[model samples]
Target: MRLFSLLLCGALLTGCASPPPDDPGGTWINQAAIDAARESGRLREALLAYGPNLEWQIHPERQQASYSNGFELVEGRLQAVGAGQWQVTFYGDYEEQLRLQGDQLTQVASGYWPEQRFARAPTRGDEQAPLGSSFEQALYRDYLGGDWLIEEGQGQGGLVRFIDNGQVQGLPGAERFALCLAGDCAAMSGEHDSLWLQAGDQGSPWLFVHEGNRLRIFEAHNRAQFDEMPEYQPGPQRWLLKRR
Candidate 1:
């Protein structure tokens, strides 16, 4: 009887010591990190740690696609060349690359990336540049900059000076890129995330995400252009910053 009782206790203890429930909340991939990987075109390797620990041997030649968390994962075919630098061929024609330092990204877009906006450049000033001068640019330059609002309008506006601490100065908002003001505001977080004024629809926004040397402007959803007005669509747009 004594032996049976000891055995039962041991069994109960063993059962209790078994692995706890799985992490039902799922993996820890933030939208920013995922966007970073996708922009770098390294979506496959970025996803390696998301699922069960499986020994995945990435074959460059024969592997048509990779799988992660039920998403028929494909190789972003992103190449990392040391020191957090990466290059990607987005949607085939669009070429982009990024250099990441700590949490800052300097994004570059060329070839197909700027095809649509190329025509507008010759007629515009710094504001119309893909990297319109903004407080964010000031931060990148001095690492300590702020701005005041000069004007505001739909599709066009002017900021007296774009600054880093837009919140502290109580500056009225201005549209930076084609994204709406609200879209640009939501992208503001810490010193890491990029900032941009959304193009149209003050409510919908464009999120500035810094991944590697690249800073991408993205939308949270999709809509059609109304009477030549830019529409907000889901997915992100990566713009290369021409170093000044």
Candidate 2:
């Protein structure tokens, strides 16, 4: 009878409630939703959606829309005057004008915002090409659709080059790699992986880590001291990214 009661209790518990399965993706940050929150005033909600240690931020002004973290990078301004019409201004040394639809952003003037855009700059220990689309989407679009190839040492393989229309030859060491189309090399390499760009490093100012079988973008600043100016290297004691 005691054994029967134990079985009955187990059956009742199983029928009433079951333990939940672990999240396959673990904790993830939704960059788009965070960006949307900035556009719509739900920053806290967005932050709550992501787990701890995941940093993000949104900087939208009367004439610009910018979100930090993840892979999407746009140093620009956006102005919304209702009717789904938005005026986007790209920031560099000069200002570039662009028009944004629901999902498609197009450059209105030539010579300003180039029709073709480069992918995010590659860091050390990477071999992907960096071309196609724009850095804006390269950082945001998770399922970027297309084929990418990479060249390592002297042989061509399934990697991506984001430098020139995803057509550039594989990069030699020391040259920056670009985010390409194919998922090949989408994650990390051994020591040569995407890293956070350090501040005042004279190179790029941000870093992206292709770890955990996924690409995670981080904002970093360099505080290294050298006899001469050494090139960037992945290491600890680096500035980690904060919420954008």
Report lDDT per candidate. Answer: 0.30, 0.30
lDDT of 1 at 234: 40
Q: lDDT of model 2 at residue 112?
A: 33
Off by over 4 Å in 2: 1-63, 67-94, 107-112, 116-193, 196-225, 232-244
Candidate 1 lDDT, 59-152, residue by residue in tens? 2243221212221222334455555555544355444454444423334445422211001111112222222222122222232133323222
Could you estimate the TM-score for every candidate?
Answer: 0.20, 0.24
Which model scores highest in TM-score?
2
> In every candidate, how many clashes are there?
25, 30
**How does model 1 fare in lDDT?**
0.30
Q: What is the Cα-based lDDT of residue 110 in candidate 1?
A: 52
